[model samples]
Target: MPAGPVRTRDEVVTALRDSAGVGMGYVPLGAAFGILLVTSGLEWWWAPIFSVVIYAGSMEFLAISLVTGGVGLAQVAATTFFVNFRHVFYGLSFPLLKVRSPIGRLYGVHALTDEAYALLATRPHAQLTGPQVLATQILCHLYWLTGSTLGALLGAGVGLDVEGLGFALTALFVVLTIDAYRSAPDVGTLVLALGCAALALAFVPGGMLVAALTAFLFVLLGRYTLRRRRVA
Candidate 1:
């Protein structure tokens, strides 16, 4: 297949501008997370550290409570796995194969946020290159880091009551879900997700989110297998 377009100066500038817009949404959310961390009894510095190291978006927000509550390492590990397991499907279709360099591919995997994935999923795969992908991810990461650090500083210097800040993450996810559905409207996928969620809520009340996602993955794989067999 032909590489759709050469990376031109204009293309790079456009990509940067596009990514900057997406990154803007992260600023307030990241700041909220930072403020929440400090308010939750963690040192303000932990905000940036978690943003840079954990980089798990909503999970990082949950981590503040987890760490402060003295959650066990085993439980934390299990939660992280379940929360991030969807990335396995993301990797199957993401343009990581276009990333030629080993280091670039490694960073691409590490930097794969919901925002980044949503942005890429909307684009034609042939049009994307490693540099463009990396540029977008890096910009988003910088926005998160800067916003979190600034919020931490503000929290440390002059504390503010940031009630309901956690809702921002939920709002972001809702927006991303809408965008993804609009990009690729698949009724089967939607049905599978809803069914799994319902079943999980009915049966595995404690682990609803993880159980739903796991069941959805299995159903999705089964569907893919049937489709492939039909094609063959």
Candidate 2:
């Protein structure tokens, strides 16, 4: 594929501005993860390693416990797969085609977090250049790395009991969801998502996230097919 257009100065600024809010969330949340990891008895350096290697925010937390508990490899793989299965759906609309360089595309895939998806996988940023998209992801990753490293260092020194820090992830998701809703404001899609969640909770509570995502994915494909047929 051809390389994407070179990013302009304005595009660079735009990417920075776009990632700023996500950075704000990531710093504290990553700090929470770092602090938890340190307090859980892991070395402070492991925090950055986890952020760099794992990069999956929620799964990284689960991984700390899994590692400390000595969970088996197969079980850990399964857990990681299920926890991040939503990324399959995320990829369906993640604007990756905008990033045309092979190297840029590879890193973009690796860095595709919820925050990046929320910021770039939308109409507003549809015109983002490859460099712009890559820059946004890079900035977000830096924010997370910095936050986790600082938190780990602090936790190792202070050993403070920072309860309720895990809730930062949930708070960040809520904010992103609100922003997503505000951007699109599609009542039908919102209602469908809620309905899918309700069904998943009612019938598959143990696998609610997977079930809900599956149901929503199928319903969305069905809607798309129907709309295409109507157009035809």
List the candidate 1 regions with Cα displacement exceeding 4 Å: 1-11
Q: Please, what are the lDDT tens digits per residue for candidate 1 over residues 1-232?
A: 3355454455667668867656667888788887777878889899989998899787898798789889999999988887888787777678888778899888889889878887776677998877777777888888889888888778777896678776776677678778778877888788889999999999999888778877987898898999999999
TM agreement with the true structure for every prediction: 0.85, 0.93
Worst 10 residues of 1 by lDDT: 1-10
What 10-residue stretch in candidate 2 is worst by lDDT?
Answer: 1-10
Candidate 2 Cα outliers beyond 4 Å, as residue runs: 1-7, 124-126
Q: Name the lDDT of candidate 2.
A: 0.88
List per-prediction Cα lDDT, in the order shown: 0.81, 0.88
Every candidate's CA RMSD: 3.6, 3.0
Best candidate, lDDT: 2
Writing each residue's lDDT as its tens digit, candidate 2 over 1-232 gives 3333334566778889988888888998888888999999899999999999999999999999999999999999999999999999899988888888999999999999988988888755456677788888899999999999999999999985658877876788789889888988999999999999999999999899999999999999999999999999
